[model samples]
Target chain A: MENTTSNQTAQNDLQVLRTSSLTGALERELEHLILTGELKPGERLNEIQLSSRFGTSRGPLREATRSLQAKGLVDAIRNRGVFVRSISPKEALEIYDIRAALFGLAGRLLTDMVTDAMLARLNEFLDEMDEIAQQRDFDRYYPVNLQFHDFLIRSTNSSMLAQEYKSLVNRLHLCRARGLVQAGGLAVSNHEHREMVDALASGNRERAQEAFFRHVERSKQRFTTTLEK
Target chain B: MENTTSNQTAQNDLQVLRTSSLTGALERELEHLILTGELKPGERLNEIQLSSRFGTSRGPLREATRSLQAKGLVDAIRNRGVFVRSISPKEALEIYDIRAALFGLAGRLLTDMVTDAMLARLNEFLDEMDEIAQQRDFDRYYPVNLQFHDFLIRSTNSSMLAQEYKSLVNRLHLCRARGLVQAGGLAVSNHEHREMVDALASGNRERAQEAFFRHVERSKQRFTTTLEK
Candidate 1:
């Protein structure tokens, strides 16, 4: 009886491991769909279609959806199914406010912990972004700009904070596709990015924090201008 | 052909919904387990034991674990089972840094949106905390202080920001159980809480933001001193 019970216990453990791995993969797939706009905001998730496409059963897929819901990527309604969360203009602006504070905290922490090598990496992006800005290459500047801000947060070495910041950036990216970079905005934005590097290099915690906080707030302003048109 | 396809789709949809709700309940139960210390930190989760205890299958249990993982309450290791994440003193301090920025953002946002009624509610808590502090009732002050911070975040009316703030608070709660409140810490903490309310009432955004930001930083400092012992 003891051997049989232990054997059954081992079998259950493997079953959980398999289900966990499946859930992880399905979560990523669903996140990609929502983030890329393939699923579209407010579009009801069709379990049958997704299950067939992914070649998985409904059990794992539903689990994945629940995970997405926890991440704020999807919302479930009573009696109705889950749908990709719709970000309102007002909501996007509010997210920007939260992001600004997170960036500021990143700056404060990074300034305290930054090494010469870290400064060098940041400056490299700073130089590249400056060149892209001068060339009025908005498209190229966008991705480089993302890397610069990302590096700033990651430099803090706080995995939890970095994870939270990335989630905010992902949601912001959805709203970003709606608006174009304003005229001369690339130069202005890159100018602030330079200021951020200088502050970090100066090792002044307050200055570094302010520089990052204002940068995101300015970006929010620029985004608002696009929405007003 | 269309009728058959639609009918089959409906069946799959119901299955998904049933699974989704089951996963939701399981997620909450698992969260409660981790938060309540019933499942100690770094303790490996026994899938068979949990499934049997909850009277559910592994599918929903695994999904719930995934959700908890997303929330940073659980850790999944390759070839090993899930365990309650142990927050070291260092990780706790790092989380506090993130929480500072979030609370600061809440203050800044709340200052802009603070109605007369909101101010009244905040002040009531402020007064209650003051009384508790004078009584040297640290135990009573703790829960009331938590409510004050929660109300500050919720006042922003940004569901996304509020959700993120709540998650940070939850993680910090795990760390909080370790350190005891220092002598007269409650009074000092409550003093800062009043300053936050004053800044909000004054309608000074910068002051409100700084007040809230520094409050969390000071709390971190207090937490660190305890950990050093």
Candidate 2:
């Protein structure tokens, strides 16, 4: 009887781990859908439909939705269901300002630590972005741009800063305003990226910081102008 | 027959609500204990003792512990149970960098929007810190110092930035290093506060941002110096 009880306990633990991992997988899948605009903002998360679509039970699905709600990627209403969070214009601008500070800090920290390999990686990003900009491909340019900034942030070796930056950027995706995507500003944005890369190469902290600061400021200006129009 | 079924459903809903609220309350209590250092870093949370101490059942207590783990306040091991998270020297310094960025952004944004009432509130914080510093009271000085920065962040009216800033500062509380607390540097810290307020009053964005950035840099320097010793 004692041996049987121990075996039961071990099985229960295994079941718990399996459920938790399932929940995590669902959460990531949902986050991808929501962030990429596939799920769209303010759309209610229908448990029945989602579970059927994913071929999973309701238990792990509900857990994943709860996790997204905790991350501020979704909103749960009393007696209602969870929905993808929608960011207001003002909130988006506020988030952009916070991102600017973080990006500037990344550039400043990178000034002292920028090695040959880091510069080579940044050069490759700029080249990829340049080709994309020439084609005026927003879809391709956008991801590369994200990757470029992500590389700089991760290179700073500050995990806390990188995590905070990523979280803000992820939430910014909920702002479905087409005007704020810097659509036609590709060449200009790439120009600014070049300036930032040049400053980083110069090993001047203030210059690198200002270049990054100005890039985000220009993007914010474009966003505001589009909103006004 | 329908009324009897509806009554049973109502009873179930009430039970669920009661359990949820109990979990939320327990989570807040646990957060308070952990953040205030009452629980201490790396100490395992004793579920039975905590539930008994709070007059709660183990069910809600376990739920609350899971919530805290999600919030990065605690770490749950496979078999050893959950323990309050400990911030390492490296992690603490990285968090400080992020907080500095958020704080500098707050100061820069406040430059354009500073009002007379905001100035009055800031003056109150400076005065409180000044008095505490003169008495060499680190215990009294610390909370006031936190409030001083918190007020500035809130006054900027950026909710996202304020939230990010608060989270970083809260995690820093997990670092139990005595050398990093700026115990004897209270007077110098207050002096920097005066400079920041002065810059904010002048309505120069660069000056305000620089003042805030440099103040944090000074504190980080103190931390590093102490760590080296």
Top candidate when judged by DockQ against the true structure: 1
Pairs clashing in candidate 2? none
Instruction: List the per-model TM-score of the A chain.
Output: 0.87, 0.83
Candidate 2: tens digits of C-alpha lDDT, residues B52-102: 998877876765776676557787775567899998989988887777777
Report the C-alpha lDDT of model 2 over A1-229, residue by residue, as the tens digit: 9999999997885687664565566778999999878899999999999998987987768757766765679886645778999999899899889889988888889999999988998999999899999999998998889888888889999988887888888988888774436997999999999999999999998788778877888898888888877
Cα TM-score of candidate 2: 0.85
Writing each residue's lDDT as its tens digit, candidate 1 over B1-229 gives 9999999998885676575576677778888887888888888888889999988888878878878887888888755889988888778888888889988888888888899998888889988988988999888988888888888887788887888888987787666346564544988888888888899999988788889999999988887777777
Model 2 chain B weakest 10-residue run by lDDT: B16-25
Docking class of 1: acceptable
iRMS for all predictions?
3.9, 3.9
> DockQ scores for all the models shown?
0.33, 0.32
